[model samples]
Target chain A: MSTPARLQPGDTIGILGGGQLGRMLAQSAAKMGLKTHIYCPDPGSPAFDVSNTFTVAPYEDADALDRFAAAVDVVTYEFENVPGPTASRLHAKVPVRPGVRALEISQDRLFEKQYLTKASVDIAGFAEINSQEDLDQALQKFNGKGVLKTRRFGYDGKGQLMIRSSADGNGAYAALGSVPAVLEQLIAFECEVSVIVARSLDGTCVSYDIARNHHENHILKTSTVPAGVTAETLNTARRMAEQIVTGLEYVGVMGVEMFLLQEDGEERLLVNEIAPRVHNSGHWTQDACLTSQFDQHIRAVAGWPLGSAQRHSDAVMENLIGFEADEWHAALSDPNACLHLYGKSETREGRKMGHVNHIKAKALTEGET
Target chain B: MSTPARLQPGDTIGILGGGQLGRMLAQSAAKMGLKTHIYCPDPGSPAFDVSNTFTVAPYEDADALDRFAAAVDVVTYEFENVPGPTASRLHAKVPVRPGVRALEISQDRLFEKQYLTKASVDIAGFAEINSQEDLDQALQKFNGKGVLKTRRFGYDGKGQLMIRSSADGNGAYAALGSVPAVLEQLIAFECEVSVIVARSLDGTCVSYDIARNHHENHILKTSTVPAGVTAETLNTARRMAEQIVTGLEYVGVMGVEMFLLQEDGEERLLVNEIAPRVHNSGHWTQDACLTSQFDQHIRAVAGWPLGSAQRHSDAVMENLIGFEADEWHAALSDPNACLHLYGKSETREGRKMGHVNHIKAKALTEGET
Candidate 1:
């Protein structure tokens, strides 16, 4: 890789995809005196409201992609689903943070599991399934209870099927459209936790504390800080995130979601997946920590020194999905609630519309620990 | 005034001005799912980078003004110098928060002083001067030391002159460009402070803690919280701010600057001037308090309930004026510093480029108190 130049305050950052994550990234960029230009296929992208410029075009439009790459000092994306050709074309013109390899590994389950296992990272027992015979054999090996997930374009519990028994193996295979899939043995875990890590261009890495998450209908409902993890477990989680970031040569923030299994007094964590972008579980850091995840990601992408992710207070971030955002007035009425609403016009079912972070102005007590 | 409907999350806010203040205001608005439309004649405005839409036309353009008003749900301004005709034209279409009365009073020094006096607010002795003779008489009454300021269009240290003796009365009068001016008695103040207050449309008001300000060349340099004033003096300042807001029927955030005089072991506060928009001194609230001054102003103009103005930490906000912004890397390297830079392409001498709030996680100690 070539040595990319550091970004200055007046430089423009080109962001791909226009969701809430992109909107927040643009806001952080503006705070550091950098302008943002959003490129997305959606005309009503939420990020456009906070960006300096935008282009409404599909990823396959080579002319639009070339123009965007020429206009910006750096390029980044909100999600890992950017087409490989698009990422390569943009990387040819301007530096792309986090690189294309991270996206390739994250976008497909088969590649993600293989990469984690090679890195000596503990993950759920999984097998690649290319046909009905392969699915049946994997189900038998995994004790007839596994998760069959499509290799690509899966999020928020979509594009996945459950293999209950060998008798239902063919039904599960058919449900997944018989695409290339990964069968992972489902482990009953106590809770889900995530670590958000940032890596600079020169390879310096920093990690935030673990976030205890709760989900409803496969969507993140709330995240709380001081995740009730032992000191040993917390250190292990941070180390795992740092290793993944360094191994990928990432130049931005990435989230590592893990499942903690508590047997007696010993706590063990299994790497569930890796998101090569800002994740929702770190939202509590916006109010509890000194530097928000958005700020850390922007700093890493811009090649600035990473900020300290020190937690100063306890926070509980609750998502206002769909119609729940109608209570925006209630959130506004709370003295300690910091509200953030994406400028989305419609409230579709299961859609994340906004969030409110309720913060207590003190760190957790010893009793909670 | 007719009862105006409350603004919702997806509503548009029309902002009149395209400076750093407007840029910060637009960022806060976007966080609450509100869009902002910036109207300013300057093509390279700092605010245009963050706003949802912008119109680069003079405020006097009635056609553009009408369209902007029609598009936005509510209208507000970043500065008090907006022309009366432009404000009136917008007010006829949509509600303009902080109303025309607040702008009318804060725009002219003579009117501000008169309004405060009528409301029984403590202010320095002053005399309106229309001729050289008037200035001479006011200087004599003020014991030959007074500040002569233009009645309108004055900010920072501009448009003002100091009269040290009677011999230079005509010189000071001519120095003011023979414009309508006001002569204020130069009090032997111990320190300068300000109070940022917000009032909702339904008449609830809240005030942030007092800010101790320091100025260099009449430009604000830093603002430190916990202003070291007696409880009585702090209460007096809040009361004065509330009185001014109620008197003007203000519907947004207003800044009240004051001079503190320590005489005979007693503290006294005299009103210096009022700004009918977000003030520089309140910038510390962004990092030290739960609700920033910008957030409060947005909520007030949107007809939402006022949030708590409580400060949770001790903060010192220093302005990054002109070349001072060159040390941005220093701030970024600090773990506890919150840096905010306005997206200005060029740096000019004495121009405000950005600011940083270095915050301590706790309040002042008993010894400091």
Candidate 2:
């Protein structure tokens, strides 16, 4: 099919998931005078509160997907776990950005590792496990220690088991519903970092400053910019991101999470995973950068030129998990805090409710750099 | 009624009028995890695109107004011209912010001038003209040169006629549809500037830095921060804004436009007019300041504590008039430009389509101060 023309100001964007990411993308789309029609199975999706229109139906409903595709000029999803058949059906009617390949690779951990290795990017050693014996054999290669994860539908530490020794791998395969999985060697990294990068339809790519992330209970808690890594390390992270996007022929923002390993007093970067959509680590851009990851993603998917990823201030973004958002009153009292609370009706434990960005003068931070 | 409790996340803010101002307000409300229900007469209202829910009914529809009031925790308006009866009706049901007093005073030029004078704020010389003779007499006091404006419902140079001389006064009263009008002495001032201030429910007030304004055909064209006024003039402007909000017992943001007169080597500020809602001149705050005018207005109306009104960078905001938004491509190519399109369907002449904020390093601009 011929390349779709660029979206005009009043055109509508069809977002495939109605979560906080889609909600933010809708807000950014509105800033550019564009409309959004969110497609989600849950009627109570947070993004539904801010979209121009929405369809409440399961992703497998061809009838609902067809109507959604007919209503918008282009289609983009907030999450990478979109069913392959669903994406293929939408692609037959309209463009599904980040394309089927990006989605297919990101949905399965083995495919992601293979793709990264093919692109000459460093990644944790991994082997696909189709049976219990496959898991036990892989563990031996990694000194009887590895993270066995389901090849699909895993997020925020779900669908995974950490095997510290051979005995720990006994029922792991059956415990994960006996589905296809991959065992990845667990590396002892100095710290976790992520690079948010965007690529335009024209193949031009840009990356924001590296964000040093901290995780609690296997969930991201905070992302601090100016990751304080050496200049060479920063460049390597950015180059790896650009290389991955280029290899995928991607046209949108992608979050590349990596491990910074300290070996012989030098920094080494390894690709941990790739999210083919806007990621949580980039939320600070909304308050600190010239263009946010959400805005960049929309611009790229709409076939518009990508904006500057330049940050105007240094920021530390902290996610408000569940009941923590109840303290929003205290967050508002800070002069330097920019709070964002996703309009989730219920504050279920372990659910992301919102985030706050604490901004500091750029000059002060740059001096330290 | 005793003070209504502060709005919690997920509470809806009922916004009257569905224009760009309301659109921005809805976006800000969404950022704070609040929902918005837009009330507008126009079915094609731009704000409807990003709102949780909306009612398309005229202000005079009491039943519709009552339904809207029932759905929201509080109500606020985009424009100051909310009819007295409509505001009173909503006020009876839900807490209407900035209060009906701000609306009643700002809706009429004569009442606004009188209210400012009573608040001990200096304003231009003016008089209320009820008849042709009154117009003829009022012009003489200003040397037969003044602006004849309708007492109510005037905006963007409409319902206004300049009486340059005695000949200019002929039929001026009839030209304004024989409505009650106000004739004010026209000041040939050095420049126009405005201060955007927000007053919280607890009566704590805060003001953003003055923005030097430039207008084209009476519509705001650009607003530059670091207005370059003397330190004393800056202090006086902030004090005047604080005094106005306190005297009106206002909640939410107000834009106070003023004239900077170079009477001698020093500068003097005279209050020109006040906007009861977010003003065009404050659009720069969205990109340059820690807390935007729209966000500040929502915080005040919701009874939440105010965020900082601090500017992180210097900025010049220019409005995109009519077809100017068609050139969004060019605006996007500028790395420092933050473009905001209003999602207007048609580009009629003299219509505001969007705006772009060009940011610069704060240190470079602050050094000039």
**Model 1 residue B17 lDDT score:** 99
lDDT of each: 0.89, 0.91
Across all candidates, the chain A TM-score values are: 0.96, 0.96
**Candidate 2, B228-259: lDDT as tens digits:** 87778888999999999999999999999999
- Write model 1 residue lDDT over A144-234, tens digit each, in one string: 8889999999999999986676766767877899899999897889999999999988799989888789999999999877788787898
Q: What is the lDDT of residue A249 in candidate 2?
A: 95
Tens-digit lDDT track of model 1 for B324-359 = 998899998897898899989999989999999987
Q: Pick the lDDT winner.
A: 2
TM-score list, all predictions: 0.94, 0.95
Q: For residue A209, what is the lDDT in candidate 2?
A: 87
Cα lDDT tens digits, model 2, A62-113, are 9998898888999999999999999999998888897889999999998999
Per-residue lDDT, model 2, residue A97, is 92
Clash pairs for candidate 2? none
